[model samples]
Target chain A: MFEIRWHSRAGQGAVTGAKGLAEVVSTTGKFVQAFAFYGSAKRGAAMTAYNRVSDKRIINHEKFMSPEYVLIIDPALIHTADFTANAKENTKYIITSHLNKEDLVKSQPKLEGKEVYVVDCMSIAMDTIGRAIPNTPMLGALMKISGMYEIDFFKESMLNVLRKFPQKIIDANMAAIQRAYDEVN
Target chain B: MAEKIDLLETEVWDGNMAASQAMRQAQIDVVAAYPITPSTPVVENYGNFLANGYIDGEFVMVESEHAAMSGCIGASAAGGRVATATSSQGFALMVETLYQASGMRLPIVLNVVNRALAAPLNVNGDHSDMYLGRDSGWIQLNAYNAQDAYDLNLIAFKVAENHKVRLPVMIHQDGFMTSHTAEGVKTLQDEEAYAFVGDFKPMNAMLDFEKPATYGVQTEEDWHFEHKARQHNDLMTKVYPVMEEVFAEFEKKTGRKFDLVTNHRLDDAEVAIVAMGTTVDTAMMVADQLREKGIKAGVMGMRVIRPFPFAKIAEVLSNVKAVCCMDRSSPGGAPGMLYNEISGALYNSAKRPVVTGYVYGLGGRDMTVEYLKGIFADGLENAKAGKPTTPLQQFIGVRGPKLNFL
Candidate 1:
């Protein structure tokens, strides 16, 4: 099973982002299970959303200890919690922050070199989405680094996921996902 | 053609094992569950089925109790014989759909491993979960040992699917007592059990592509009262008869006959204790000890609690000089949940015995048959005096003092 963990606070649409990713992954005929767990069980608390992708049925219902990919919507969370404790040597990290690759490495020295992909999801979110919610943009970085899905597929799925939201916000979030997908290189 | 096989020579399994076997035997199309104590074993066993390729179904590992019930509702409405398991707070979380499933009359059968609802939050066996849903239109059946858990579950699906009673059913077994308790139970053969469930052809399948219709219609007293009244009348009257008929039919097929209620040694008894679920075991053992002591004590086990079975409860306890009502539920405004109901049922009777209500084991108090002996002694005390109260109630086994607090 390919486990993808998303780190974000509540009310930041991380649950929506995880479910949206589920919708996209499901389009590829792969069985997908996406859900979230939190400690405080309240809004704005640091929470983890998880996804398990597999060819066969998944029986393990606990939190993922070993993840294939990690999408950090808030780079600040890296220091607050043990985000990479369960990560393997071959793990891919797609981080969303204002800093570039060299500065990010300087900030978190342990993350020096390990298939690391960076995206200015904050600036992208403000420019396109007009808000600080960077989950959609970070998800775009996931598509770029993981290459498990196409950018256009996430774009289409995002349209459906954000259909109930404001129309202007929808267009901007779509643009943010695309921008992150481009900048993750 | 010699297709169907006989039921007697099937494999013997334990109650917990029988529950898992029956879910598979029933060909459950979908299972959505979140892990909770006591109820966790069934889901864990079901997960093993998915891993070992025993059952052909999608299992959704949900985040919380709400999502678990929602997923099952979605699957059931789409014409699948869906099932889910829960206990305690998990059962409390499904309260909304517990009402919806019955209001929609979706014939959803849920297995509740009864647990104590907590303030300090205990995860042990109790009846608080099913008690919270007494008014919710689900047929409630309490199971004693693992064997009753196995037996009631088989009949639950049959009753729920009956056109006359297309309502949700809650088959409750005590959390650690019956759910975790290991005991021998007989499961029907695969081919025979399949023939038993037959095809789960829902009358109002919301997913029938060709024949479209609405279900769970929202209303504001136009036809709502009529629909509700019809539901209640059918559930109390029509369903009772159909329930008996189905049991008879099942006995013909599986060679196992079950009664709605079992009055164990009630005849010529001076006092009887009324209880359900695993407490019945304790009551039975206590009955034996009481007989040795020459107390003339007996046990009455409740099979159904939803339709209340008021008439039956009144009839059985009428002869006994006093009845001790053992309950695991606490009603905030009234006496013990079952106590109030039993008292109301026996209120008009000319020989209304002195009834005592006990609301112990709130969040798992480790109830034993000896406890029943104490309660029966209390009932006998009230009875031998030849004086009964207009309304009598007391929590039999509270911490310090027992009083009619409510």
Candidate 2:
């Protein structure tokens, strides 16, 4: 079983992204539960969504206070909140920021030596669409770190589930997801 | 006022302790709590029970209401009969978990003591907090007074975990009216309570180490929807008789009978008042005075609010000319949330009577007998013309129609 936590602001689509991932991973015949803890009940408030991926049926429904992975959708939160509170010792960190691998590690020394992958998801999202919803890009980065599933499978799931949104948005998200899956290191 | 105290059986405690004791009596193996107002007392009592060896359970002291409920989902899935208590805005924080627990098919019991959801921040009695999660797939029950609070709790656990109808149940009562009010509560000896309701053996539990089974695992669209449909049909239809049977069993054990709904005097009445919770008392009084003055009116207190005794309401109120529903909540984009659900249930009947719904109390504005007199008067006046007399959830006895009746 793998417990993963996603940290982002409320309006940044982190919850939606986590839920979409769970829905996609469900096709693998694995059990997954995705949820978020949010306060102020408003957009832009810092929020954390969680996912528990298990080959066997999962019964532990609590949020990932102690997680195997932390997927950061916004770099701003790293300076603000202690993202490592519940992280495990060999925790894999997937951070979405403009900074390269070296400076990102220097910014948070505690994360040094951990399996950390940094990606410029914001630039990717903005280049693809006009806005900064890096959830898709971060998912791509998560794919690179975890290597659990094919990028094509996840991209297909995102397109299938987000069909209700405009095609441009869908295409852009698909592009963002694809680029992060390839470029993140 | 010096409160009257009693002892001997359990412990000398008040209503909060009573709720805690009931949770314990029902054999709650997992409890998640983050102390807040009105609700804080119950959690404190829970901690007291845990410390004094009152309950054999894991109490996860969470940092926030969201964590409390999330932990409860975990513990409940672990195959333990899990429970929690909260009120007002605390309930708001619990809303997401509320839906998740239901969809995940976790049979957890929550005591939603009614308190005001605030903008001005008043910690008092009201239904607005729980009102937001009305459609959260919980078997909602409202207790009129203290005894109802205790008895209904016992019934809640039984109904919630029944294999035939595995659904969460929310037992709500006025925050102070029942949460703090001292009343004579008959707590069966642990053996008696346990015996009356068989040991809760969760189906396909996550905690059964001997025969390990998966809980909250993913399902295909076909299987997922199937489980949900089965849950709904069983709870909505099969539960009708089960509700009566459980109530009958409870009555036999305690010599106290509870109807799915209690009808006032609807035989020859033209205007009928419908409500739930402590407001029922004021409604009954006003209904009595209205009948005396030849208003041809009556009141009906709805106890079982979910799988909401709609058939009974239709059977009883179909004969009445016009029925006025005094809802304590405002449904977004509509008038009353309960009123809308009730109306939808009654819409298809051929003898569809006129249904007038008004948002009666918001933010726990007092619903005294005098205020009820005005509500009945409004309903009676509206009945003559077939329309609503006042807004559905406006604060009574307050100036400028607070929130302008939503």
Candidate 3:
């Protein structure tokens, strides 16, 4: 089973990102469970969502206590939340950060050993979508790191999910995804 | 909520979304809903469907949960296919009209996302509202996951609208635990689902003015006794049999079988846990782990809570040496509702098992695998000692003092 946990503020689309990923993955005939844990329903409150994928049906409905992959959509969560508290030894991180990998590790040495892929997702979203919603860009970073699906697959699937939006919004999100996919390191 | 999913293919849906699809495919005539946590999406998605011209239905935005059920009653009494959704306090608000819906024999299907009733005010998943509506005369069905949520809603419409069981049905899914969690759900083709539920045949419908019927009439001492007896005794007795037939038909159509009670590792087992909602899946996982360690742990998941499956529960649990009854809702000052019911089910059995009551996961607290293993360990010890080691009823993961009661 591949377990993933996502941390983000309420309006940042982490819940939708997790759900979108689950929907796309299930198309490949894998069993998946995606859920979000919410507190207050305000726009800026920190919240977490989770995903579990397996070749077999998943029966456990509890929260993912130990996740293999951690995706942080809100970079501020790195300092504000214990995003890595339950991570395994080989747990990988796909973080939406403005800081480079060296500066990130220099400031937070605890993140040195793990497979940490950092991207300027907020800047990417701003440059591409003209908005700071980093969820799609972060998902691109995740796809790039995990190789769970081809970047085009995520783009097409996400475009389908966002089909209701205006053409510009859709094009911008697609552009953000492509840039994040190419630039995450 | 309105992103298109290919209805022709199997798709991922949360419990709320799955139930919403059932409502949409069933082609419900009216949905009167008040937005509440964990339950809002069920009706919200329906509203989206209504907006997208995906369904032909009336979406009523009522001011409160009470008004929502009242609107459902109005629409249902008018011989329209009607449904609504709510959780916790919202459900509690509608308690007064719950009896009106069932007693009037209106077959309104209610989707109840089970959440804890508030004093501390929790928005997470629990069974407090489920237990609160236990005596409300609605035929209650519990879903452990997304698939069950989808399947049970379709079955509920069929069973509730049946001539023999013209009663309202409350389909319960653990609030956010199931409602907000997305998983792969096998869906029936819209035509197949509509065909399975058949057409709406409303009996004694208010709209049929040719054969006029009076609803909500006062029943004083003269005829109240017989009405109560028929409503509570005779008709309630018919639900299980009707459900059995419906289950059979659903399995034949969708290839998914449902029982009043679902068992896992129960055969030839010495220790078992009895519970409802999401906890059942967690207990089953723990039971499998216990089996790996050479312990005879089993799980009994109660699918239907009302018209309590007494005989089936007794028969399934009769052989176990120890049984733990998991109640996700708080009892406040009494033993958990499941505990009391299970105790009554086994009260006259030939072989008496050491039954213990455990109140856990109240207000959406997580029922971890570790906690479940500890519960099984305690139950096994109780079986070995032929009695409960701790109090007969106790709270599992609550903070502060270990609260126990007789």
Number of the predicted model whose TM-score against the real structure is largest: 3
Measured with DockQ on alpha carbons, how good is candidate 3?
A: 0.77
**What is candidate 2's lDDT per residue for B165-215, written digit by digit as tens?**
777888888775556543334467766776776788878787677888766
What pairs collide in candidate 3? Answer: none
Candidate 1 or 2, higher TM-score? 1
Residue B33 of candidate 2: its Cα lDDT?
87
Worst 10 residues of 1 chain A by lDDT: A56-65
Backbone clashes, each candidate: 0, 5, 0
* lDDT to native, each model: 0.75, 0.74, 0.89
Which regions in candidate 1 have their CA more than 4 angstroms from the true location?
Answer: A1-185, B1-15, B252-256, B388-391, B400-406
Q: What docking class should model 3 receive? A: medium
Model 3, B233-301: lDDT tens digits are 845588888999999999998789999899888888888999899889988988997899899999999
Model 1, residue B158: C-alpha shift (Å): 0.7
Query: Candidate 2 DockQ score?
Result: 0.01
- The Cα error of candidate 2 at residue A75, in Å, is 60
- Compose the digit string of candidate 1's lDDT tens values, residues B37-90: 778878888788777777777889999988888888777777878888899999
Q: Show the colliding residue pairs in model 2.
A: B358-B392, B359-B391, B359-B392, B359-B393, B360-B392
